[model samples]
Target: VSQWLKMKGKDPSIVPLLHPPSKEKENVSQLTLEPIYSSFNDWATQFFEEKANGYLACKLCPPSSRTVYGPKTNPSNRSSHVIDKHNLEPPPYLRNRKRVREVKKQKQQTLAETPIFATTEREKQRENIVIVYATNLLSASTLDDPLWRATFGEKLAGMYPQLLKEMTIEYSKNLDKVFFSRAFGPCCLMADGGKDISKHKLLGSCIKANGKIHVHELFNTENEVLDTTWYQKYFSRVITDIESRSNLVVVGITTDNEKSVVAGLKKVVKTNDHLIRIACGPHTMELFLDDLAKNYKPLSEAIKQARNFCVYVRNHKQPLSALKKYQVDVNGNPVKNPLTLVLSNNTRKWSGGFLMISRILRLRSECERLLRNFPDVPRLSWSSLEDARDYLFEFYLQEQILQRDSSNLIHYAFCWRQMGRHKDSIVESLKATNHDTNVLAISQCFVKHQEKMEACRVFDLCCLLWPVPPKTNNHSYFVNATAQLHYLVLRQWKFYQDHADALQLPEEYRGTNENLRLTFLNKAKGQLTMHYEAVELEWRDPQHLFQASQEITEGHLRQTLQPTPNLSVPGISVEDYWRSVACLCPELRFVVRILLACSASEACVERIFSDEGNIHDKIHNRLDPAYSESQVKIKGNFLVERERKLREKDFGFEELEWEEE
Candidate 1:
């Protein structure tokens, strides 16, 4: 710019003298924080690497004919490259030699054995025929070692087309028969629903409880009928084929909060049994976010405007010109987004793509009366407004208090208590935002809550529901200590009400009615509610419940043993169990594991997910080549080490021998 000034008839020396080269005439313009990069090539290269640009990349690929191959070789019946490149692959008959090799081996074996054992050729034939007819026809294929290389093999079979074509078709037809049978096989194959981690999409019935969380299978109602509902009606028949398993009825389900599965299941469970439903913790968290905007109206407006500021400023001249002239400050870090995406000005740290946008909104607001011009923007999340308000109101207090507490127990106790609302806020916000950051934050914030809640529920539910022999005695605290307690209390009450006449009944029934239990529960609850309320648990953290409950009096079994891990399985390490379960239940494992691992009982699962938000859709393609995930239904974390172990294992379980776990 200084050299240009010298060439253009102005004093070039003036450029160095000015602290900044550009400023508005009114002296009211915002200072440009962006640093100018010396290398446009490096800048542009780094700029396009972010995942957000991925969608746009697909649009840039207009079709072309592979840039045209080469001079047309003498036109031949077979592709020249196949003939030239893959001669060793054999013609169709020879390729099928492996298929027929077993028969040839049998014939060869019979000839050898027949000469030694038979008196005559005809006698040898009868002996061989007798053994051969009884022998099982077999080729080496297995459930564990299914041949998937056929996909690549078919592509390689182009050589000797006339000789191989018919054989290739026969091979394919045989493979197809195997494939169709597998796909149509008993749907004992239950893949995760891609959203809900709480409920498996099978004949899962609610375990009776008063405040039991309703775990419901999620399904896409708009496009196709889901397995959840299909199994609901036909599960009885399906189970008959396997074993007759019973179903349980409860208040509702805990799912990702979609109405489709919830609604369908409600219809299936409908009867005089009395059932309704609700969304799971993650889904409910979503509700809170949208509600945030409606309640904290300002934050909603701010986020919407923040979003619009990015869109609006790129079209407006003032901001666009300023951005073009401005250099990004962080090593000219090749702007995290396209110039069009970041055209608006903002003064905040601008750490996030969204926050950067929000800052732009702020910058635009300062320049123009944006708030007054637009009262409501469509699709602006409500939680953004509520989150801003909570940060200023509630979270601010939490941050200050949490920072000052030096003693861990007191600090943790207070932090645990103080953090409940914030976690709730984050979970709600994340659910609303569908933003992994918010989800992760929620997981981290109130992980204790989930730990406590799930632990209490799991123990209570399993003990009460497990088809085990009833013990001579059980304690109130033991049953109630579990997550299932409150709901179990309710179910016990309902069971009495339905069967027991309140005033005049089987004397046995009257003793166990809701009125009788409520009276005792109200008194018991009165003694503890204040202390329990001292720190409400975080939903993301399931382990915290056990920890928090540890402060309470011990149960009979617990008095002798350490508190059981809140996780569903008992024989495995909590961490290891959850690590594997996360594959089967990624979202739930994400929430539960974070809670278990943290001292404060708030694992940052939501935060971690937020950090990984860009890869949510990319996870399948980005597999670590371990875990043998390709062509399989579920995949997980531990990718690199898993691949290393898989290669070492030589693609089979137990090193050439089969063993049951």
Candidate 2:
């Protein structure tokens, strides 16, 4: 404790002297035998009189013991000296405690006389009120509500401009810092057009990098409908601006598969082979389903009949009442299986058709009953309804799975492969239901797109880089996939071999021979192949038959291929499992990290469009486009910064502990 106090620059040694000795008397003797003085003023004014040199004659001090104490201009100072040195206490009128109390009372009285405007607490209160009022005004927040008006005062209602000006200046400074920061990775830029409340089309671009939305900017499109050339120029400028500001490399761009958008992206990708262009996955899938619904005769007729039936029930009163009547329990309470066709629209999500079909099928018996009662109503064919359900059941389930967000890098590979399986299952089910190939032809169109999606080079690599082995988990196809990956790697090696003179070398190998470069490539390829074969062999030889003599024995391979019992056991995801065994495939880990950062869909940017605030309402139509853009950018970047800081703190602490150990 004493050392701590000394470190704090405190005089720990003087603690004992702070409390004086108890031997000293508590009350001192009165110094004078004169009559009791009324007050210090009365005593000085009556007998001694003040001197010219700011001193007062102390006649009482001389009579008691001491030489005259000259300073009486300040009565307290004189009394303290008399009490401490001369062993004398002051009279009641001149007591130090009473004087202090009177001074405090006077201060309180002065404060009571002051106005509320001059006080610091009231100033702060008013400032807060103005800020809230201004925010409500600028954001088009409901100000007329009695509840809001009662909450924040009616005063300072027009303070929005002042607050907004100050905020804009401060926000600009912060945005500059964010733009210049080199924290983000190579980004995927996504742009799509949306409409404001006034039906004005707004072209918005959002940059997604490092698993966060880094920026979202909106531009008023005016009268120019986005054409192929317009989009090409706009996207190029967007990329250059983002790269210049954030130091981000533009890796990929994603948009819906609109005709104009597809053409625009084609133009951008023509000369930029290093950059990727992705047709928004969910949108592509939605379009495929839309086409299937239109072209497939049985499904089309079934859906049309269902829609007509639903419309008749909704528009006519008798059928609607009957549906409610039929949907009741034994105790007379209404059941909630009320049915509607919910006809799919173009803007509906990918799963909209499936949901609609499922609901119609669920109410099939009820619909049949309703149809029997209405003689004039056209009937829905049972075969058509059954066929449509059978064809769509597997697809509906598959779409549900695909629409979910996958957290792991390996899931991209896993999901696409599962999609292939779902397509096959749908075909087999269709074959069993019908002998004809008419339905099969329609399904193959979607299957072709799925195949194209799986052909993405990075996706193929991710599949090959999956940490586990094939045979034990029933993945024979991966063997061929691995060979294809090896072939791709060899092609790159051959290219580098041919262009050894033109190749940029690492710092350590800048002056090395061409043979050394080939040797390095050969060595790396050998290690990768060895690791691949060892994992495959261990999976095939589950009994450990080849354990004794091999360079990477079956036992070592088993340890690598099998998940750790406590660490990679059940309930752990594939991504987390691969992360745990990252040491096993150190070379693959880097590519996996980069591929994980790449989004498979434009869902992030679509979400940005859907996040329009009240500031975009018609009431606030005159609001500056720059203000809207900055607001979104700040909101998104602030969230990203918060998550990044938290993760850094958590992982950094864990890393420090691991290092110490």
Candidate 3:
């Protein structure tokens, strides 16, 4: 190759020998061996990353990739197959005049000289002129808005830096985003007297599109009235800004169960037609505890004790720390939160925030001890605790969670033996009628809360007059009217002739059937009518659920009778069937005549739950996932001294024993 290159007026010394060629005569014999790696133009290139016919055809790998030919390939195998030593493809370029001579000459000369560092006078002047022009055009006042404070924390402190100094920088970072602030639609405001959540205190509203929940957190002040006013101003401003930028509308407002938030939204919307007001169902449910307590004082008192017991276990961690003090189960886990000792799943809320019955029993021993020592610690009285427990026992058995058995008959019997929650619910509703402030709204809530068959007669007539004349009734097809008519039929058919005048079931429908066959058949026809109607619900609807379950039960019973022997059709034992129906549907008892020869057990009903829904469960089974919280240890390793020094009050986390590696 060297001789050939020199003949063509190229560099005589072109190819580099991998090892320095020996000058000794004896080394000439070693040159007889084939090179594992070859070279060109003294350049050290990877043998595996070059293109030439001596290598295999490239697969999916880049074209630059190279390999010696063969199926069994390895790092040590660098041989080109024996047949292809001469039959090869040409490379991209040869060790020639264009590559070696000219390129090498330029590279050597360039490396020998020093690099220039200074810019030309014209270039320097051009950059400085650009900077000066931009400086004069820009205004420093642009930094005054919340935008600057959002991006640059300390450098651009907000107007009220002292007030916001305590809040986290990340919380206020929303102001930095221009895209989010502009070209937006659909903003809703929500406010409540904020409570501290572990590390931070927050006041915010949800402004969103479709289903995206964007939190617009605003600053809050200590002065309660001023705090509310600030939120209102912020909410109103954002709404107006959004409306101007885009054709946006305020659809709904959801607030916590607080009086202040309700009062704030009340200012903007009057009848809830434009701005739909929704309260957190969980919060409204919490208020039920207060109502239940007033109606059945005994149950509330006990629940208080149970809550104190759970809190005490947390406060006095030392007592629960040792394994020997409280024996571990066979699984080596400690007994669950002692709250279960007082509050059973029966009447307990799903979140298990606090229950009256369990609190009483769970706190019994603790209360006695507190009385013996520091009597000043407040707790429920013994008489109140007993009443609370007795009342809650009934609620627990009545609730699907606590009574796991399908035997609503048995569950109801057992629960009723204790006390009925329906009684408390009704009593609470009746008491609201006396309140003059929300006299109308409260009355509406009252009727809905404790619904009864006979009570629904008023709403039936009200439905007839719903759209008066010009507007059509909500009932769309014959199916919808048939559905409503069935409701009317079942109700009218069941009512005693004596009660007919009081109910006023429209004028033509007033007369009672003198013939027993027609009356019974008409009543059966209403039951037999297959009709469907859709209801517009704000959120959760339990009434629909009850109706659905009852429908399925009655349908299945009638279908089962179709194949019976001796009789033309199969039929349920009327007494038992009606009694069982009454047991499940509290509203049906008035017309159904649910008196059973013997009260039915709830076991069948519970088994039926697996088919219908998960409405039946044992006391412990009914407890919400939150109650199981104290059961598991948190995941991930601890962070050394940081986790160790973290006080109990700083965050509601249990202290860990080890540091993360």
lDDT of 3 by residue, 1-661 (tens): 5566788998755444534566664453365543333323122233334335444432323458433444345422332221143333324353353367678888756542312111556434422321121111111111211222222223222322322223323333433243255423333333433333232234534343322233344444444454445545655665565556454455445565456556656664443323444444334433544454445433444565655544554445443242123444558666565433333333444224234344444446644654455444445567655543443443543252132322122222223323332554544554554422332443343343322211122222212211111112332221122122222322333332333343332443345333322343334333322221222121023333323333334344434323221212233233333433432333343223211211223343333233443221110111222322222122112222222344322433332322110
Q: How many residue pairs clash in each candidate?
A: 50, 0, 32
Worst 10 residues of 3 by lDDT: 133-142
Ranking by lDDT: 2, 3, 1
Q: How would you encode candidate 1's per-residue C-alpha lDDT over 435-489 as one tens digit per residue?
A: 3243453354245344432222232222222111112132222222222222333
- Top TM-score model: 2
Q: lDDT tens string, model 2, 47-81?
A: 34455675555555665653343554456555555
Model 1 residue 145 CA deviation (Å) reads 32
What's the C-alpha lDDT at position 306 in model 3? 53
After superposition, candidate 3 runs with Cα above 4 Å error: 1-189, 195-202, 227-234, 241-248, 271-273, 320-353, 359-386, 393-421, 424-661
Arranged by TM-score with the best first, the candidates are 2, 3, 1
What lDDT would each prediction earn against the true structure? 0.33, 0.47, 0.35
Better of 1 and 2 by TM-score: 2
Model 2 score (lDDT): 0.47
lDDT of 1 at 289: 37
Instruction: Show where candidate 1 strays beyond 4 Å.
Output: 1-192, 195-252, 272-278, 294-297, 305-490, 498-661
